[model samples]
Target: MYVVFFYQGLATHLSAKKSALEQLDGYRLRLRKSEEEFHHKEDERHVVAETLKKANAENSVKTAVESDGEEEDEEDADAGSEEDGSRGYTPSPTPAKSRAGSHVSPT
Candidate 1:
């Protein structure tokens, strides 16, 4: 009778151990899946961030080019106005005389 009770106890212990091992395996699988999802999301975020940086750089370059073009246009307009002299305004001769007078050495 005692031998039968010992055998039953051993069987029960083995069954419990097997159940615990299965639970541990299930938990490990869930953790691995969660980690994989997190990595995937991180990769996507990096890609988007890089894309945004590139777009911003391109926009800044375009803006700089446009600003330079505007400056050149304004310079051209000023030069054109000066050459045509259609505004009925004559430039003063005093500035040229002053520059020449300054070059004369005082004896």
Candidate 2:
């Protein structure tokens, strides 16, 4: 748009200035098209990055939930074993783990 006035200021021959203005307009159009393509690709990249982040967050949450559930199950099993031991119930055939140094014979 500036060339609309710039051409008037140029002292060069009218034909030469007109040709130059036309070339400038073509270059401007190509630059604008290139910028549009660049912006579009940037936007696509951003969307993909956001989606990947969301997926990772979801996976992290799910993994934490599963870990907590497994820990609770292990706790329940350990509590049940402790209760049986305290009550002096007969040990299961699999046997309980012996305490450290319990194999020492009394004098």
Candidate 2 stretches with Cα past 4 Å from truth are 1-12, 86-107
Candidate 2: how many backbone clashes? 0
Check candidate 1 and list the clashing pairs. Answer: none
- Maximum-lDDT candidate: 1
TM-score of every candidate relative to the true structure = 0.72, 0.65
Estimate the lDDT of model 1: 0.91
| RMSD per model, one decimal | 7.0, 10.6
Residue 27 lDDT in candidate 2: 100
lDDT of 2 by residue, 26-94 (tens): 999999999999999999999999999999999999999999999999888878878878543565788
Candidate 1: worst 10 consecutive residues by lDDT? 95-104
Compose the digit string of candidate 1's lDDT tens values, residues 1-107.
99999999999999999999999999999999999999999999999999999999999999999999999998887778778984445677674445645575789
